[model samples]
Target: MTLLICAFAAIIATVKWYKDAPEGNMKLGILCWMYWGASIMWLVDAIFEYAELKAEYFTPAPADMLNDAFLGLAVVALGLIIWLVWLLIKDPRGVVKAALIRKKA
Candidate 1:
């Protein structure tokens, strides 16, 4: 089924991101994985929406599909919040600070 294909695609994409993420930026790698998961979720949701639209032109009940999309967005938002909160609370000496310090004149 299409959903199965989508699931496989998502898993492959996530693995690819994990492999390709920059070595020095672990935070960035986590963020990338979060975003990649979200993107794949939305991509699957879009495919569902398109299929529903084509099958039933007048009434495309895409609520389930939209829910998946929102779930993806929520996951990404939650991951970002966790990362930012960690920076504020745990890792005060963040990577951004070092980058900024280097750029200072």
Candidate 2:
């Protein structure tokens, strides 16, 4: 479930990054990297668990599945938060700077 969720996010982020390739001002590339990295990590974890559990690996308990879903959502949310913080700090279009200057005036 974790792998599935992350792979979806990675795909979506990658596509968005490609579409925005010309301008490249949103710092979306960072988001793509983060999602891909998470997907790879989950893939590796699934592989090791499968090797250990063999046939039983497919049958996860209901509670475990729920936990994995929550964790995946949390990870996606964290990635977005980080990206937003980066965008605010960079102020690529000078929006934040302009707002601050206006407030001072």
Candidate 3:
């Protein structure tokens, strides 16, 4: 299940990178941020589940732990996806400018 989640994430990251490659570095940066955010979320959830299993005398059922981890990751991923979509809506051009361009001539 973890592997499947990771694989889907990898595909999203790849597509985002490829989309940004030709246009602007900002898209790449945002996509990378989104990817890392997702990865970190899952990593933290896994650690927590690991600790939970270790602390209990009875090991958590595989299905239970897996469900918890999947739930946590899905929540985090959903938040990030929403934010990414918001960013896209806000910046339809997909460019991040350090400074606004002005007509001097």
lDDT of each: 0.56, 0.90, 0.61
Error of 3 at 32 (Å): 3.1
Q: How far in Å is the alpha carbon of 31 misplaced in model 1?
A: 1.2
What is the TM-score of candidate 3?
Answer: 0.44
Better of 1 and 2 by TM-score: 2
Model 1: runs farther than 4 Å from truth? 1-26, 55-77, 88-105
Cα displacement (Å) at residue 43, model 3: 2.3
Q: Residue by residue across 13-73, what tens digits does model 3's lDDT show?
A: 6677777677654344554556566666767876786677765624657987689568757
Candidate 2, residues 15-56: lDDT per residue as tens digits? Answer: 999998888799898899999998998899999999999988
Report the C-alpha lDDT of model 1 over 10-45, residue by residue, as the tens digit.
465457656866553334445556555656675677
What range of 10 consecutive residues in model 3 has the weakest lDDT sum? 94-103
**Winner of 1 and 2 under lDDT:** 2
Name the weakest run of 10 consecutive residues (lDDT summed) in model 2.
96-105
- TM-score for model 2? 0.92
Highest TM-score scorer: 2
Instruction: Arrange candidates, best TM-score first.
Output: 2, 3, 1
